[model samples]
Target: MKKPVIFLSLLASLIASQSCTNLEEQVLDESFSPSISYADIANGTLAPVYALLPSVFLHTNYFAIQEISTDEAILPYRGGTDWGDNGIYLALHQHTQTSTDPNLKNTWNFILQGISRSVSAINEFQGKTDATSQLYLAESRGMRAYYSMLTLDLFGVVFVKNSVGETSKVIRGAEAVEYIKSELLAVEPNLSTTVGPGRLNKAAAWGLLARLYLNAAVYRNVTAQTVTFSNDDLDKVIEYTDKIINSNQYQLSPDYFSIFNSDNHSNKEIVFAVDQRAELNGHNRLAYFSLSGDQFPLPAFPAANGTDGPAITSDFYRTWVNAYGSQDPSVDPRFYKQNLSIYSNPADSCVTAESFNINRGILRGQQYGLIRKNGVFLKCPDGKMKVGKLYNDTRNRPTTPVIFTEKVDFTVAGSDYSTGYRVEKYEFSKKSSSGRNLGDADIVILRLADVYLMRAEAKLRKSNDAASALADVNTVRASRKAATPPPALTSISLDLLYRERGFEFYWEMLRRTDMIRFGKYEDTWTEKTNTDRNKRIFPIPQTAIDGASNLPGYLVQNPSY
Candidate 1:
């Protein structure tokens, strides 16, 4: 079968097997005729799209690939085997390619399917006017533009279809942007401004537009071309940001951990989150993949290897630690939380000793000690987080020296060892009886903190003297308990902003985009140094190319394919 058809079938199977009930029975009637009223079809279409958003991060598949591909984050120290493959894809995306990869095809197919469903709803409800119908249509358009942005970011071209067929025409970069803007702008007037936290509303649509305009430079090859942000676009960003920030609808949680807790879904910090329901085919990847071998932290789980944890990269970890050098590290809780050190120094032989050594923090099995004095974990030769400890037989031995074979989560309460640092940003603090999958913590997609950083970049680009920009950028730093914001600056560069973003939005999937936008796609690193520039955009999977051959060159493979 064609790739798209195969994918759709896969999605159907997943839904049928995993959903609480048959999706067709709950959301649609398989018995319903193709001639069903357009209004019903529009409402029925929402279930799948809403379901897909949270599932995007269900594996090391799209979530890590999209982020690591850009620069927001990396899976260094070989914690995760697949992250390097993601790195390869990102490197290749920087230039055009004739390469065909199945994973790339799957990502493209899923993203485009989302867009197609969104467009189908729009097409079906051209003149529907019932209150529910209008709301659903607006929501559908907002979602459509959201997915369209994904296409524009990854592929630089997309097929903008109005119906659920194969004859849709391809929309290229600038053209795609225009189409997205039109859809969002049209839906803004009709969308209810008072929607709840997880669902899309007027501000969500506007926020997506802000992102598009903010990255317009890179999207249209204008980042280094003296391109200026249109006043209108800037105004819209500020306008939407202001609405979300001041609407009393959402507020930044005083504690960062509260933002991702299972009980914290309604927290004001979240602007838009993929609604993930547990054990029933929801977004459970973070909780699943992030956990260590389920050994040290929880003694009862099946895959409990205290050593197989996902530690933060040394480079990225340094960015967080450097933010607070002038003062005592003990005073800054962000460091402790963001970079937890649990390994007991074997030589010190002091169980009562401080959780970390003042000089050498965590020791990896490679026998190298990362300097905690500087606040960054020393990375392995490859970019993955260094592995501190490994389990030999899952026998629950604490003192045994396990090899550095897998990723470990040291920050997770039970794991007492670390190669470098564990990402505590999304760490679940509470226990869930339901298979340990009740992390209701709403992942912040676009929070006020990101807005300030984006505005700071815009200001830096506009006004060479960016002392105010520095202040705005540092506001997020201060939120993390920095003594004071990073120093004011008379002038700023993208490098500075890029570092700030790494510190501010690390692990939030903005890294790859930020790196690409700042023209750092070609920059080298310990493991990610030799990536191909064209790999910046993932290949238009070989499967997709073959499926589209019947469309002539309309669906031509991306260059190099």
Candidate 2:
């Protein structure tokens, strides 16, 4: 639903009044603003807080730092020109990021904005006795805690502020952990259990809590050589995840890809997500981001194409090859799904069809799509459609066939348009037939599979119950059935669990954190060689540091910026 214009104006004014460094800025005192009534406040105060989520998760913002920095994904300058934004992506992948990186700055700003907006919503809802107002008040607080969790995850610090104009106390380590946990616990009772996944509810709060406790050790020691996961914390992870699992509110989708389909808003597997319905200015970047520029999914809109973005790293691709030796990974349903059936016969291309979908999962080898001639799609003599091998014509390399090589290099010659395997996990939105803008798929933030995995990890780490952990892992694996379904694992280990997470959640933007938690972040992969532990947490953005310069110790840069 669209928010009131008056509320939007007030929010704009509040944001404009403060500098980027001050996340806890002075919100416009809505008590004096007569234009907004309790009805309007109840309807629109929380909209902006939720609205900031899409931008925060955009491909160029938080997704870049989360995925590109890990071995799971890489983004080199295509043709030594495209995506060369001052080597920001290269620096991120290689662990050479400084305080001034634009991607970091953008990610920091967007997250802080979410926190700022949440604070504003809380301030607007305080002391109102209406049932709706009280419900929103609890939700606002819950969202603030969630945003704080993200802040702590990325920058190793959480900003604490209760109301407008209040100074935000930066807390880290154990103190920050307790602060975030208390906020969620305080609001849990009042949160609705039946609200959709887009909004914070009782189950979402529990999911977030489980996630926090699962990674508490990492947050507790951002720079330590080895950190210990406490038994109590692991127990908490199990407890919370068990609550979600028993609630029966979610399940593992039999069709693994359906969980990410365009109509996934109603998918029971999703515990929490950013509702990117088209009416709310949703975008299709996630679907288009990792695809090749020459590959177009929609036949009606030839202009809607990929941007030749990031691709899977060879180090990551090897994980699948090593796991299932002597068998192609595509035998597992999650590894690949061939949707373009007409292309099965390479020589017989002519087919009468109006539209078709490209293959899903990890895409490699020569690509194919509709051929064009004289600025129009070429058709067979019978007026039927025709498909041919795709070329790098979109990147001015028409002579070069679009064959994705398994290996990639940082050098310009080695990082061409067709250097590495691409991923097409999220289905392209049919609503975005005109271009890559309007997307209806809700971006998944938390899901039931993750809940099970977390519980399994806790069981293994806390009690060394390998049998129970293996049960949980196999439960997820068996849910995804295909012509040749994935076999149940006869064993389980920390390393095996880590690889399973990669297979399940790849391109969902959880790689960097997973790598660090699995103690593999510092391992040499592809072009990255640095093994510095201090680089675990990104440096606090330079702009934020400068903005808080006058206030001594308000915002200290992470160690070894």
Clashing pairs in 2: none
Q: Which regions of candidate 2 are displaced past 4 Å?
A: 1-40, 347-355, 373-375, 381-385
Cα lDDT tens digits for candidate 2, 456-506: 999999999999999999999999864456999999999999999999999
lDDT for residue 446 in candidate 1, whole number 0-100: 75
* Candidate with the greatest lDDT versus the true structure: 2
TM-score of each: 0.74, 0.93
Model 1, span 105-195: residue lDDT tens: 4455566656656766676666877887788888887887887788777777755666555456677667777888888888888888777
Cα lDDT of all candidates, in order? 0.54, 0.84
Could you list the CA RMSD of all candidates, in the order they appear? 8.9, 5.1
